[model samples]
Target: MKMRARCCLIALLIILNWAQQAPATEDVPGVGSLPPEVLKLLQDLNRQYGPDTVTLVSWLLDAATHSGSVLTASVRVTGNEAREDGTFLVFQIETGLIFNTRVFDQSGRLTVLWSKILAQAFAHLDTLQIPADGVMIDLLYHHKAFAETDDLSEHVDEPGSVEEAKFYFPGDPLRAFLGKKLSSPALLARTQVFINDTPVPYGAIRTETANGSH
Candidate 1:
Protein backbone atom coordinates (compact mmCIF):
# COMPACT_ATOMS: atom_id res chain seq x y z
CA MET A 1 0.00 0.00 0.00
CA LYS A 2 2.88 2.47 0.89
CA MET A 3 4.68 1.71 -2.38
CA ARG A 4 1.49 2.32 -4.42
CA ALA A 5 0.88 5.68 -2.69
CA ARG A 6 4.47 6.87 -3.42
CA CYS A 7 4.08 6.00 -7.14
CA CYS A 8 0.78 7.93 -7.37
CA LEU A 9 2.48 11.08 -5.88
CA ILE A 10 5.36 10.80 -8.38
CA ALA A 11 2.89 10.54 -11.30
CA LEU A 12 1.01 13.65 -10.08
CA LEU A 13 4.27 15.63 -9.84
CA ILE A 14 5.21 14.64 -13.39
CA ILE A 15 1.84 15.79 -14.69
CA LEU A 16 2.27 19.14 -12.93
CA ASN A 17 5.71 19.59 -14.43
CA TRP A 18 4.34 18.82 -17.91
CA ALA A 19 1.62 21.43 -17.45
CA GLN A 20 4.21 24.05 -16.39
CA GLN A 21 6.35 23.30 -19.44
CA ALA A 22 3.44 23.60 -21.90
CA PRO A 23 3.58 26.58 -24.29
CA ALA A 24 1.09 29.36 -23.79
CA THR A 25 -1.44 30.12 -26.56
CA GLU A 26 -0.63 33.45 -28.15
CA ASP A 27 -3.69 35.74 -28.27
CA VAL A 28 -2.15 38.79 -30.00
CA PRO A 29 -4.91 39.59 -32.50
CA GLY A 30 -4.69 41.83 -35.61
CA VAL A 31 -1.05 42.86 -35.09
CA GLY A 32 0.18 41.05 -38.20
CA SER A 33 -1.90 43.31 -40.48
CA LEU A 34 -0.10 46.55 -39.52
CA PRO A 35 2.28 48.25 -41.97
CA PRO A 36 5.99 47.54 -41.64
CA GLU A 37 6.82 51.13 -40.70
CA VAL A 38 3.90 51.29 -38.27
CA LEU A 39 4.94 48.06 -36.56
CA LYS A 40 8.51 49.28 -36.32
CA LEU A 41 7.43 52.63 -34.89
CA LEU A 42 5.16 50.93 -32.35
CA GLN A 43 7.95 48.68 -31.18
CA ASP A 44 10.38 51.63 -30.93
CA LEU A 45 7.93 53.73 -28.93
CA ASN A 46 7.14 50.82 -26.61
CA ARG A 47 10.83 50.38 -25.85
CA GLN A 48 11.20 54.12 -25.21
CA TYR A 49 8.10 54.79 -23.06
CA GLY A 50 6.86 51.57 -21.47
CA PRO A 51 4.21 49.49 -23.28
CA ASP A 52 0.84 50.96 -24.36
CA THR A 53 1.80 54.61 -23.67
CA VAL A 54 2.14 55.23 -27.39
CA THR A 55 -0.56 54.19 -29.88
CA LEU A 56 -0.91 54.35 -33.64
CA VAL A 57 -3.29 57.26 -33.98
CA SER A 58 -3.30 57.37 -37.79
CA TRP A 59 -1.21 56.55 -40.86
CA LEU A 60 -1.35 57.48 -44.52
CA LEU A 61 1.20 55.64 -46.65
CA ASP A 62 0.18 57.61 -49.71
CA ALA A 63 -0.68 61.24 -48.96
CA ALA A 64 -1.27 62.01 -52.68
CA THR A 65 1.26 64.85 -52.99
CA HIS A 66 5.02 65.43 -53.15
CA SER A 67 5.13 64.08 -49.60
CA GLY A 68 5.21 60.27 -49.71
CA SER A 69 3.32 59.31 -46.56
CA VAL A 70 2.21 60.62 -43.18
CA LEU A 71 2.29 58.88 -39.82
CA THR A 72 0.67 60.43 -36.75
CA ALA A 73 0.88 59.17 -33.17
CA SER A 74 0.00 60.32 -29.66
CA VAL A 75 2.13 60.27 -26.47
CA ARG A 76 0.03 60.37 -23.36
CA VAL A 77 1.21 62.58 -20.48
CA THR A 78 -1.34 62.55 -17.63
CA GLY A 79 -5.08 62.54 -16.81
CA ASN A 80 -7.72 62.00 -14.12
CA GLU A 81 -8.14 58.29 -14.84
CA ALA A 82 -5.49 55.59 -14.30
CA ARG A 83 -3.65 53.35 -16.73
CA GLU A 84 -2.34 49.87 -15.98
CA ASP A 85 1.02 51.45 -15.10
CA GLY A 86 -0.64 53.65 -12.49
CA THR A 87 -0.55 56.69 -14.78
CA PHE A 88 -3.39 58.42 -16.59
CA LEU A 89 -3.56 58.97 -20.36
CA VAL A 90 -5.81 61.73 -21.54
CA PHE A 91 -6.78 63.45 -24.79
CA GLN A 92 -8.65 66.73 -25.08
CA ILE A 93 -11.81 66.94 -27.18
CA GLU A 94 -12.04 70.73 -27.50
CA THR A 95 -8.38 71.32 -28.35
CA GLY A 96 -6.05 68.92 -30.16
CA LEU A 97 -3.60 69.03 -27.24
CA ILE A 98 -2.97 65.31 -26.91
CA PHE A 99 0.82 65.00 -26.95
CA ASN A 100 3.51 67.25 -25.48
CA THR A 101 5.85 66.89 -28.44
CA ARG A 102 4.01 67.37 -31.75
CA VAL A 103 5.84 66.51 -34.96
CA PHE A 104 4.45 67.43 -38.33
CA ASP A 105 4.43 64.48 -40.77
CA GLN A 106 5.92 66.00 -43.88
CA SER A 107 7.95 63.41 -45.87
CA GLY A 108 6.89 60.11 -44.26
CA ARG A 109 10.30 59.66 -42.65
CA LEU A 110 9.84 61.18 -39.21
CA THR A 111 9.69 57.92 -37.27
CA VAL A 112 12.75 59.13 -35.38
CA LEU A 113 10.86 62.23 -34.27
CA TRP A 114 8.01 60.04 -33.06
CA SER A 115 10.40 58.09 -30.87
CA LYS A 116 11.87 61.34 -29.54
CA ILE A 117 8.41 62.53 -28.56
CA LEU A 118 7.75 59.33 -26.61
CA ALA A 119 11.05 59.71 -24.80
CA GLN A 120 10.27 63.30 -23.95
CA ALA A 121 6.89 62.24 -22.55
CA PHE A 122 8.47 59.63 -20.28
CA ALA A 123 11.03 62.19 -19.14
CA HIS A 124 8.23 64.63 -18.35
CA LEU A 125 6.51 61.96 -16.24
CA ASP A 126 9.72 61.34 -14.30
CA THR A 127 10.33 65.03 -13.73
CA LEU A 128 6.79 65.91 -12.66
CA GLN A 129 6.02 62.92 -10.44
CA ILE A 130 2.36 63.42 -11.33
CA PRO A 131 -0.13 61.43 -9.27
CA ALA A 132 -2.64 59.01 -10.77
CA ASP A 133 -5.62 61.32 -10.10
CA GLY A 134 -3.83 64.39 -11.50
CA VAL A 135 -5.43 65.90 -14.58
CA MET A 136 -3.56 68.03 -17.16
CA ILE A 137 -5.40 71.23 -16.39
CA ASP A 138 -2.59 73.35 -17.86
CA LEU A 139 -2.58 71.79 -21.35
CA LEU A 140 -5.16 74.19 -22.76
CA TYR A 141 -3.67 77.10 -20.88
CA HIS A 142 -0.32 76.53 -22.64
CA HIS A 143 -1.63 75.53 -26.09
CA LYS A 144 -4.76 77.63 -26.56
CA ALA A 145 -3.52 80.07 -29.20
CA PHE A 146 -1.56 77.52 -31.20
CA ALA A 147 -4.51 75.10 -31.18
CA GLU A 148 -6.81 77.80 -32.55
CA THR A 149 -4.30 79.05 -35.15
CA ASP A 150 -2.62 75.74 -36.10
CA ASP A 151 0.82 77.13 -35.36
CA LEU A 152 3.48 74.41 -34.98
CA SER A 153 5.66 75.96 -32.25
CA GLU A 154 4.62 79.04 -30.30
CA HIS A 155 4.68 80.06 -26.66
CA VAL A 156 1.61 81.04 -24.65
CA ASP A 157 3.15 83.98 -22.79
CA GLU A 158 4.31 85.88 -25.89
CA PRO A 159 2.11 88.79 -26.81
CA GLY A 160 -0.26 88.53 -29.80
CA SER A 161 1.40 91.67 -31.22
CA VAL A 162 4.70 89.76 -31.37
CA GLU A 163 2.95 87.67 -34.01
CA GLU A 164 2.20 90.90 -35.91
CA ALA A 165 5.68 92.32 -35.16
CA LYS A 166 7.34 89.25 -36.64
CA PHE A 167 4.81 89.09 -39.53
CA TYR A 168 3.66 85.73 -38.11
CA PHE A 169 0.08 86.71 -37.35
CA PRO A 170 -2.48 84.30 -38.83
CA GLY A 171 0.32 81.68 -38.66
CA ASP A 172 -0.14 79.51 -41.77
CA PRO A 173 -0.49 82.51 -44.06
CA LEU A 174 2.91 83.83 -42.94
CA ARG A 175 4.68 80.63 -44.04
CA ALA A 176 4.51 81.70 -47.68
CA PHE A 177 5.92 85.11 -46.79
CA LEU A 178 8.82 83.55 -44.85
CA GLY A 179 9.36 80.95 -47.58
CA LYS A 180 9.95 83.72 -50.07
CA LYS A 181 11.77 86.11 -47.71
CA LEU A 182 13.99 83.55 -46.01
CA SER A 183 14.79 81.02 -48.74
CA SER A 184 17.90 79.51 -47.13
CA PRO A 185 17.64 76.03 -45.53
CA ALA A 186 20.79 76.69 -43.50
CA LEU A 187 19.40 79.96 -42.15
CA LEU A 188 15.96 78.55 -41.37
CA ALA A 189 17.46 75.68 -39.42
CA ARG A 190 19.55 78.12 -37.42
CA THR A 191 16.80 80.67 -36.80
CA GLN A 192 15.85 80.33 -33.11
CA VAL A 193 12.30 80.82 -31.88
CA PHE A 194 12.18 82.73 -28.57
CA ILE A 195 10.40 79.98 -26.59
CA ASN A 196 13.11 77.53 -25.53
CA ASP A 197 15.97 78.34 -27.90
CA THR A 198 14.92 75.15 -29.65
CA PRO A 199 14.81 75.28 -33.42
CA VAL A 200 11.82 73.57 -34.96
CA PRO A 201 12.28 69.89 -35.70
CA TYR A 202 13.41 69.02 -39.20
CA GLY A 203 10.46 68.57 -41.60
CA ALA A 204 8.22 70.52 -39.22
CA ILE A 205 8.71 73.75 -41.19
CA ARG A 206 8.80 72.43 -44.77
CA THR A 207 8.32 75.17 -47.33
CA GLU A 208 8.02 75.25 -51.11
CA THR A 209 11.16 77.38 -51.29
CA ALA A 210 13.23 75.03 -49.13
CA ASN A 211 11.53 71.81 -50.33
CA GLY A 212 14.18 69.91 -52.35
CA SER A 213 17.17 71.91 -51.03
CA HIS A 214 17.47 69.91 -47.78
Candidate 2:
Protein backbone atom coordinates (compact mmCIF):
# COMPACT_ATOMS: atom_id res chain seq x y z
CA MET A 1 0.00 0.00 0.00
CA LYS A 2 2.87 2.39 0.84
CA MET A 3 4.52 1.82 -2.59
CA ARG A 4 1.21 2.40 -4.35
CA ALA A 5 0.64 5.71 -2.53
CA ARG A 6 4.19 6.90 -3.43
CA CYS A 7 3.64 6.09 -7.13
CA CYS A 8 0.37 8.05 -7.11
CA LEU A 9 2.14 11.10 -5.63
CA ILE A 10 4.90 10.87 -8.26
CA ALA A 11 2.32 10.74 -11.03
CA LEU A 12 0.57 13.84 -9.66
CA LEU A 13 3.87 15.75 -9.65
CA ILE A 14 4.55 14.81 -13.25
CA ILE A 15 1.09 16.00 -14.31
CA LEU A 16 1.57 19.31 -12.52
CA ASN A 17 4.90 19.84 -14.28
CA TRP A 18 3.36 19.18 -17.65
CA ALA A 19 0.52 21.58 -16.97
CA GLN A 20 2.94 24.33 -15.99
CA GLN A 21 4.87 23.92 -19.22
CA ALA A 22 1.80 23.86 -21.46
CA PRO A 23 0.61 26.89 -23.41
CA ALA A 24 -2.56 28.68 -22.42
CA THR A 25 -5.71 27.09 -23.82
CA GLU A 26 -6.96 30.49 -25.00
CA ASP A 27 -5.09 33.59 -26.03
CA VAL A 28 -5.24 36.79 -24.04
CA PRO A 29 -7.87 39.06 -25.59
CA GLY A 30 -5.92 42.11 -26.83
CA VAL A 31 -2.27 41.16 -26.61
CA GLY A 32 -2.29 37.55 -27.71
CA SER A 33 -1.40 38.33 -31.31
CA LEU A 34 1.63 40.51 -30.58
CA PRO A 35 5.08 39.43 -31.70
CA PRO A 36 7.11 37.53 -29.15
CA GLU A 37 9.62 40.37 -28.68
CA VAL A 38 6.90 42.96 -28.24
CA LEU A 39 4.97 40.70 -25.91
CA LYS A 40 8.09 40.28 -23.79
CA LEU A 41 8.62 44.05 -23.60
CA LEU A 42 5.00 44.63 -22.61
CA GLN A 43 5.27 41.95 -19.96
CA ASP A 44 8.39 43.65 -18.59
CA LEU A 45 6.61 47.02 -18.51
CA ASN A 46 3.61 45.55 -16.74
CA ARG A 47 5.90 43.99 -14.17
CA GLN A 48 7.41 47.38 -13.48
CA TYR A 49 4.20 49.45 -13.43
CA GLY A 50 1.79 47.08 -11.76
CA PRO A 51 -0.23 44.56 -13.74
CA ASP A 52 -2.13 45.77 -16.83
CA THR A 53 -1.29 49.48 -16.56
CA VAL A 54 -0.16 49.78 -20.20
CA THR A 55 -0.66 47.89 -23.43
CA LEU A 56 1.26 48.27 -26.66
CA VAL A 57 -1.29 48.31 -29.45
CA SER A 58 1.18 48.41 -32.35
CA TRP A 59 4.66 49.43 -33.44
CA LEU A 60 6.39 49.89 -36.80
CA LEU A 61 10.05 50.33 -37.61
CA ASP A 62 11.59 51.40 -40.89
CA ALA A 63 15.19 52.15 -41.76
CA ALA A 64 14.99 52.42 -45.55
CA THR A 65 13.81 56.02 -45.57
CA HIS A 66 17.24 57.75 -45.44
CA SER A 67 19.76 55.27 -46.80
CA GLY A 68 19.90 53.72 -43.34
CA SER A 69 21.14 56.90 -41.67
CA VAL A 70 17.79 57.48 -40.01
CA LEU A 71 15.22 55.24 -38.43
CA THR A 72 11.58 56.12 -38.89
CA ALA A 73 9.14 54.56 -36.49
CA SER A 74 5.60 54.79 -35.22
CA VAL A 75 4.16 53.46 -31.98
CA ARG A 76 0.62 53.30 -30.70
CA VAL A 77 -0.21 52.78 -27.05
CA THR A 78 -3.27 52.80 -24.83
CA GLY A 79 -4.23 52.48 -21.20
CA ASN A 80 -5.43 49.26 -19.61
CA GLU A 81 -8.98 49.94 -20.84
CA ALA A 82 -10.35 48.10 -23.82
CA ARG A 83 -8.68 49.32 -27.02
CA GLU A 84 -11.97 50.49 -28.54
CA ASP A 85 -12.98 52.23 -25.34
CA GLY A 86 -9.87 54.35 -24.80
CA THR A 87 -7.56 56.81 -26.48
CA PHE A 88 -4.78 55.74 -28.88
CA LEU A 89 -1.62 57.80 -28.52
CA VAL A 90 0.36 57.68 -31.73
CA PHE A 91 3.97 58.78 -32.16
CA GLN A 92 5.85 59.33 -35.42
CA ILE A 93 9.59 59.50 -34.82
CA GLU A 94 11.57 60.41 -37.89
CA THR A 95 14.95 61.70 -39.03
CA GLY A 96 16.48 65.07 -38.24
CA LEU A 97 15.09 67.34 -35.53
CA ILE A 98 11.45 66.78 -36.42
CA PHE A 99 8.90 64.25 -35.14
CA ASN A 100 5.09 64.09 -35.07
CA THR A 101 2.46 63.20 -32.46
CA ARG A 102 -1.24 62.50 -32.79
CA VAL A 103 -3.86 61.70 -30.20
CA PHE A 104 -7.03 59.77 -30.93
CA ASP A 105 -9.17 59.84 -27.84
CA GLN A 106 -12.07 57.43 -28.23
CA SER A 107 -13.23 58.07 -24.70
CA GLY A 108 -12.62 61.52 -23.24
CA ARG A 109 -11.84 59.87 -19.94
CA LEU A 110 -9.14 57.64 -21.44
CA THR A 111 -5.55 58.64 -20.78
CA VAL A 112 -2.09 57.21 -21.63
CA LEU A 113 0.61 56.56 -19.09
CA TRP A 114 3.77 55.64 -20.97
CA SER A 115 6.75 57.72 -19.92
CA LYS A 116 8.69 54.77 -18.57
CA ILE A 117 7.90 52.52 -21.48
CA LEU A 118 8.76 55.19 -24.03
CA ALA A 119 12.10 55.76 -22.39
CA GLN A 120 12.79 52.06 -22.59
CA ALA A 121 11.72 51.92 -26.21
CA PHE A 122 14.10 54.69 -27.16
CA ALA A 123 16.87 53.08 -25.18
CA HIS A 124 16.37 49.86 -27.07
CA LEU A 125 16.42 51.72 -30.37
CA ASP A 126 19.60 53.47 -29.36
CA THR A 127 21.34 50.09 -29.41
CA LEU A 128 21.25 50.22 -33.22
CA GLN A 129 23.44 53.36 -33.28
CA ILE A 130 20.75 55.37 -35.06
CA PRO A 131 21.68 59.00 -35.39
CA ALA A 132 19.69 61.27 -33.11
CA ASP A 133 19.50 64.63 -34.82
CA GLY A 134 16.50 65.38 -32.64
CA VAL A 135 13.74 63.69 -30.73
CA MET A 136 9.96 64.20 -30.54
CA ILE A 137 7.81 62.76 -27.82
CA ASP A 138 4.16 63.00 -26.88
CA LEU A 139 3.42 63.49 -23.22
CA LEU A 140 0.05 63.04 -21.54
CA TYR A 141 -1.51 62.27 -18.17
CA HIS A 142 -3.77 59.30 -17.45
CA HIS A 143 -6.89 59.38 -15.31
CA LYS A 144 -7.27 57.02 -12.38
CA ALA A 145 -10.52 55.83 -13.92
CA PHE A 146 -8.50 54.35 -16.77
CA ALA A 147 -7.15 51.58 -14.57
CA GLU A 148 -7.19 47.95 -15.75
CA THR A 149 -10.27 45.75 -15.84
CA ASP A 150 -10.42 41.95 -15.80
CA ASP A 151 -13.15 41.80 -18.43
CA LEU A 152 -12.29 43.87 -21.50
CA SER A 153 -14.98 42.31 -23.67
CA GLU A 154 -17.71 44.29 -21.93
CA HIS A 155 -16.08 47.60 -22.94
CA VAL A 156 -15.99 46.66 -26.61
CA ASP A 157 -18.11 48.71 -29.04
CA GLU A 158 -18.38 51.67 -26.66
CA PRO A 159 -18.72 55.01 -28.41
CA GLY A 160 -15.84 57.43 -27.97
CA SER A 161 -14.31 60.64 -29.42
CA VAL A 162 -11.03 61.56 -31.15
CA GLU A 163 -8.59 64.48 -31.10
CA GLU A 164 -5.24 64.97 -32.85
CA ALA A 165 -2.35 67.42 -32.66
CA LYS A 166 1.12 67.32 -34.22
CA PHE A 167 4.24 69.18 -33.17
CA TYR A 168 7.49 69.72 -35.13
CA PHE A 169 10.94 70.64 -33.84
CA PRO A 170 13.61 72.12 -36.06
CA GLY A 171 17.42 71.76 -36.26
CA ASP A 172 19.64 69.12 -34.60
CA PRO A 173 18.55 69.45 -31.01
CA LEU A 174 18.45 65.84 -29.90
CA ARG A 175 21.43 66.02 -27.59
CA ALA A 176 20.24 69.21 -25.92
CA PHE A 177 16.70 67.92 -25.48
CA LEU A 178 17.96 64.71 -23.89
CA GLY A 179 20.07 66.51 -21.30
CA LYS A 180 17.21 68.11 -19.34
CA LYS A 181 13.83 67.46 -17.82
CA LEU A 182 10.97 67.59 -20.36
CA SER A 183 8.05 70.00 -20.14
CA SER A 184 5.14 69.61 -22.54
CA PRO A 185 3.94 73.22 -22.70
CA ALA A 186 7.42 74.55 -23.08
CA LEU A 187 8.17 72.05 -25.80
CA LEU A 188 4.88 72.78 -27.55
CA ALA A 189 5.58 76.49 -27.52
CA ARG A 190 8.81 75.88 -29.41
CA THR A 191 7.17 73.65 -32.02
CA GLN A 192 4.97 74.20 -35.04
CA VAL A 193 1.53 72.72 -34.45
CA PHE A 194 -0.94 71.06 -36.76
CA ILE A 195 -4.48 70.09 -35.93
CA ASN A 196 -5.77 67.16 -37.96
CA ASP A 197 -2.80 67.75 -40.33
CA THR A 198 -3.48 71.46 -40.90
CA PRO A 199 -0.56 73.60 -39.88
CA VAL A 200 -1.24 76.17 -37.17
CA PRO A 201 -0.06 79.54 -38.47
CA TYR A 202 2.88 81.15 -36.74
CA GLY A 203 1.93 83.05 -33.56
CA ALA A 204 -1.44 81.27 -33.44
CA ILE A 205 0.04 79.14 -30.70
CA ARG A 206 2.10 80.95 -28.08
CA THR A 207 5.85 80.34 -28.18
CA GLU A 208 8.25 80.29 -25.28
CA THR A 209 11.96 79.52 -24.89
CA ALA A 210 12.12 76.22 -23.04
CA ASN A 211 14.42 76.14 -20.02
CA GLY A 212 17.68 74.98 -21.55
CA SER A 213 16.11 75.45 -24.96
CA HIS A 214 18.00 73.64 -27.69
Candidate 3:
Protein backbone atom coordinates (compact mmCIF):
# COMPACT_ATOMS: atom_id res chain seq x y z
CA MET A 1 0.00 0.00 0.00
CA LYS A 2 2.82 2.44 0.82
CA MET A 3 4.49 1.58 -2.52
CA ARG A 4 1.28 2.35 -4.39
CA ALA A 5 0.96 5.71 -2.61
CA ARG A 6 4.51 6.67 -3.68
CA CYS A 7 3.75 5.71 -7.28
CA CYS A 8 0.64 7.89 -7.25
CA LEU A 9 2.58 10.85 -5.88
CA ILE A 10 5.19 10.50 -8.64
CA ALA A 11 2.48 10.38 -11.30
CA LEU A 12 0.90 13.56 -9.97
CA LEU A 13 4.26 15.35 -10.03
CA ILE A 14 4.80 14.41 -13.66
CA ILE A 15 1.35 15.60 -14.62
CA LEU A 16 1.88 18.97 -12.87
CA ASN A 17 5.22 19.52 -14.60
CA TRP A 18 3.70 18.86 -17.99
CA ALA A 19 0.92 21.30 -17.30
CA GLN A 20 3.33 23.99 -16.15
CA GLN A 21 5.38 23.84 -19.37
CA ALA A 22 2.45 23.38 -21.70
CA PRO A 23 3.06 25.99 -24.35
CA ALA A 24 1.16 29.21 -23.68
CA THR A 25 -2.42 29.11 -25.01
CA GLU A 26 -2.93 32.39 -26.90
CA ASP A 27 -6.19 31.55 -28.61
CA VAL A 28 -8.63 30.35 -25.95
CA PRO A 29 -11.51 32.62 -26.84
CA GLY A 30 -9.98 36.11 -26.37
CA VAL A 31 -7.09 35.16 -24.09
CA GLY A 32 -4.69 37.06 -26.39
CA SER A 33 -7.01 39.76 -27.55
CA LEU A 34 -6.25 43.41 -26.69
CA PRO A 35 -9.29 43.88 -24.51
CA PRO A 36 -10.28 47.18 -22.82
CA GLU A 37 -8.60 46.63 -19.48
CA VAL A 38 -5.37 45.52 -21.17
CA LEU A 39 -5.43 48.62 -23.33
CA LYS A 40 -5.91 50.77 -20.23
CA LEU A 41 -2.92 49.08 -18.63
CA LEU A 42 -0.73 50.03 -21.57
CA GLN A 43 -1.80 53.64 -21.30
CA ASP A 44 -1.02 53.67 -17.60
CA LEU A 45 2.43 52.22 -18.24
CA ASN A 46 3.11 55.02 -20.70
CA ARG A 47 1.99 57.51 -18.08
CA GLN A 48 4.78 56.26 -15.89
CA TYR A 49 7.02 57.34 -18.75
CA GLY A 50 5.46 60.83 -18.85
CA PRO A 51 2.37 62.89 -17.97
CA ASP A 52 1.32 63.58 -21.56
CA THR A 53 1.93 60.00 -22.70
CA VAL A 54 -1.18 58.04 -23.68
CA THR A 55 -2.52 55.29 -25.91
CA LEU A 56 -5.85 54.65 -27.66
CA VAL A 57 -8.69 56.37 -25.86
CA SER A 58 -11.03 54.70 -28.32
CA TRP A 59 -10.73 51.55 -30.41
CA LEU A 60 -9.94 51.81 -34.10
CA LEU A 61 -9.03 49.60 -37.04
CA ASP A 62 -5.92 47.40 -37.06
CA ALA A 63 -4.08 50.06 -39.04
CA ALA A 64 -4.27 52.76 -36.40
CA THR A 65 -2.21 55.72 -35.23
CA HIS A 66 -1.29 56.90 -31.68
CA SER A 67 0.39 60.23 -31.01
CA GLY A 68 2.46 61.64 -28.12
CA SER A 69 3.58 65.18 -27.33
CA VAL A 70 7.18 64.82 -28.53
CA LEU A 71 6.48 61.81 -30.73
CA THR A 72 3.87 59.75 -32.60
CA ALA A 73 2.99 56.02 -32.76
CA SER A 74 1.31 53.64 -35.18
CA VAL A 75 0.55 49.94 -34.77
CA ARG A 76 -0.73 47.66 -37.51
CA VAL A 77 -2.27 44.32 -36.64
CA THR A 78 -1.07 41.96 -39.34
CA GLY A 79 -2.82 38.62 -38.91
CA ASN A 80 -4.83 36.28 -36.70
CA GLU A 81 -2.35 33.88 -35.11
CA ALA A 82 -1.31 32.57 -31.72
CA ARG A 83 1.01 34.78 -29.67
CA GLU A 84 4.65 34.04 -30.40
CA ASP A 85 7.88 35.89 -29.99
CA GLY A 86 8.53 38.17 -32.98
CA THR A 87 4.94 38.05 -34.16
CA PHE A 88 4.82 41.84 -34.09
CA LEU A 89 1.81 44.09 -34.51
CA VAL A 90 4.13 46.63 -36.15
CA PHE A 91 4.64 50.15 -34.70
CA GLN A 92 6.31 53.31 -36.00
CA ILE A 93 7.27 56.17 -33.64
CA GLU A 94 9.19 59.32 -34.58
CA THR A 95 10.32 62.52 -32.92
CA GLY A 96 12.03 65.86 -33.52
CA LEU A 97 12.85 66.74 -29.93
CA ILE A 98 16.50 66.84 -28.88
CA PHE A 99 18.38 65.88 -25.69
CA ASN A 100 16.74 62.70 -24.43
CA THR A 101 17.87 59.25 -23.20
CA ARG A 102 14.95 56.84 -23.43
CA VAL A 103 15.27 53.08 -22.91
CA PHE A 104 12.42 50.95 -24.24
CA ASP A 105 11.31 47.30 -23.62
CA GLN A 106 7.92 46.47 -25.09
CA SER A 107 8.43 42.92 -26.41
CA GLY A 108 5.61 41.04 -24.72
CA ARG A 109 2.27 39.40 -25.46
CA LEU A 110 -0.59 39.88 -22.99
CA THR A 111 0.16 43.45 -21.89
CA VAL A 112 0.83 45.29 -25.10
CA LEU A 113 2.26 48.01 -22.92
CA TRP A 114 4.92 47.63 -25.54
CA SER A 115 6.31 51.12 -25.85
CA LYS A 116 8.40 53.81 -24.09
CA ILE A 117 9.18 57.48 -24.65
CA LEU A 118 12.35 59.55 -24.12
CA ALA A 119 11.67 63.18 -24.88
CA GLN A 120 15.06 64.61 -23.94
CA ALA A 121 17.14 61.87 -25.65
CA PHE A 122 16.06 62.81 -29.17
CA ALA A 123 18.64 64.13 -31.70
CA HIS A 124 19.72 64.78 -35.36
CA LEU A 125 16.72 66.35 -37.05
CA ASP A 126 19.07 68.80 -38.76
CA THR A 127 20.44 65.99 -40.89
CA LEU A 128 17.64 63.42 -41.11
CA GLN A 129 14.61 64.17 -43.24
CA ILE A 130 11.43 63.42 -41.38
CA PRO A 131 10.40 59.89 -42.50
CA ALA A 132 6.98 61.37 -43.02
CA ASP A 133 5.49 64.81 -42.50
CA GLY A 134 3.79 64.49 -39.10
CA VAL A 135 4.23 63.98 -35.37
CA MET A 136 5.33 60.60 -33.89
CA ILE A 137 5.69 59.10 -30.42
CA ASP A 138 7.01 56.08 -28.39
CA LEU A 139 7.82 53.89 -31.38
CA LEU A 140 10.83 51.86 -30.23
CA TYR A 141 13.66 51.08 -32.60
CA HIS A 142 13.68 47.42 -33.69
CA HIS A 143 17.49 47.12 -33.78
CA LYS A 144 20.13 46.57 -31.13
CA ALA A 145 22.79 49.21 -30.44
CA PHE A 146 26.14 49.49 -28.67
CA ALA A 147 26.90 51.91 -25.84
CA GLU A 148 28.66 55.19 -26.51
CA THR A 149 32.46 54.99 -26.36
CA ASP A 150 33.42 58.66 -26.33
CA ASP A 151 32.54 61.72 -24.18
CA LEU A 152 33.35 64.91 -26.06
CA SER A 153 30.97 65.02 -29.01
CA GLU A 154 28.78 68.12 -29.41
CA HIS A 155 25.03 67.80 -29.04
CA VAL A 156 22.72 68.22 -32.00
CA ASP A 157 19.79 70.47 -30.99
CA GLU A 158 17.16 72.36 -32.97
CA PRO A 159 15.97 70.47 -36.03
CA GLY A 160 16.80 71.94 -39.47
CA SER A 161 19.17 74.48 -37.94
CA VAL A 162 22.63 73.05 -37.28
CA GLU A 163 25.06 72.60 -40.17
CA GLU A 164 26.85 69.49 -38.87
CA ALA A 165 26.18 67.07 -36.03
CA LYS A 166 27.50 63.75 -34.67
CA PHE A 167 25.64 60.55 -35.61
CA TYR A 168 26.06 56.99 -36.87
CA PHE A 169 27.27 57.80 -40.34
CA PRO A 170 25.51 55.99 -43.23
CA GLY A 171 22.49 55.29 -41.03
CA ASP A 172 18.95 55.49 -42.28
CA PRO A 173 16.91 58.49 -41.07
CA LEU A 174 15.65 56.62 -38.00
CA ARG A 175 19.08 55.38 -36.95
CA ALA A 176 20.79 58.65 -37.81
CA PHE A 177 18.50 60.71 -35.59
CA LEU A 178 18.83 58.36 -32.62
CA GLY A 179 22.61 58.24 -32.99
CA LYS A 180 22.82 62.00 -32.57
CA LYS A 181 19.79 62.82 -30.44
CA LEU A 182 20.43 60.07 -27.93
CA SER A 183 24.24 59.77 -27.74
CA SER A 184 25.80 63.01 -28.96
CA PRO A 185 27.65 65.43 -26.60
CA ALA A 186 29.03 62.31 -24.92
CA LEU A 187 31.01 60.98 -27.90
CA LEU A 188 29.27 57.63 -27.53
CA ALA A 189 30.24 54.90 -30.04
CA ARG A 190 32.24 57.24 -32.28
CA THR A 191 28.89 57.64 -34.04
CA GLN A 192 28.31 60.35 -36.62
CA VAL A 193 25.43 61.18 -39.00
CA PHE A 194 25.99 61.28 -42.79
CA ILE A 195 23.90 62.04 -45.83
CA ASN A 196 23.21 59.22 -48.26
CA ASP A 197 22.81 61.11 -51.56
CA THR A 198 19.39 62.32 -50.49
CA PRO A 199 18.59 65.97 -50.88
CA VAL A 200 18.28 67.98 -47.68
CA PRO A 201 14.97 69.46 -46.55
CA TYR A 202 14.46 73.04 -47.71
CA GLY A 203 12.97 75.89 -45.70
CA ALA A 204 12.82 79.69 -45.75
CA ILE A 205 14.54 81.75 -43.10
CA ARG A 206 15.44 85.41 -42.70
CA THR A 207 18.97 86.06 -43.97
CA GLU A 208 21.36 89.04 -43.83
CA THR A 209 21.60 90.83 -47.17
CA ALA A 210 24.92 91.57 -48.90
CA ASN A 211 24.84 94.91 -47.12
CA GLY A 212 25.00 93.06 -43.77
CA SER A 213 21.47 93.85 -42.53
CA HIS A 214 18.55 91.49 -41.94
Number of the top candidate by lDDT?
2
Q: Which of the predicted structures, 2 or 3, would earn the higher lDDT when compared with the native?
A: 2
For 157-214, candidate 2 gives per-residue lDDT tens digits of 3312223444444322322234434433343445555545566654444223435432
Ranking by lDDT: 2, 1, 3
Candidate 3 to native Cα RMSD, angstroms: 21.8
Candidate 2 regions exceeding 4 Å error are: 1-90, 93-156, 181-186, 200-214
Candidate 3 lowest-lDDT run of ten: 55-64
lDDT of 1 by residue, 1-214 (tens): 2233333223323322333343324322334544556445544433443322332111110111112111121222333444333333332211112222333222221222122321122222212222232222111111112344444333423412211000001222223323443333433354322122233354454333555231
Question: lDDT by residue for model 3 over 1-214, one digit each (tens)?
Answer: 2233333223323332333344324222322344556434443433332211122111111111221222122222222222222121222222222222223121121012111122122321223222222122222322122234421112322222211111222224334434444332222222222222222221111112223111
Give the winner by TM-score: 2 or 3. Answer: 2
lDDT of each: 0.27, 0.31, 0.25
Runs with alpha carbons beyond 4 Å of true place in candidate 1:
1-28, 55-214
Q: Supply the global lDDT for candidate 3.
A: 0.25
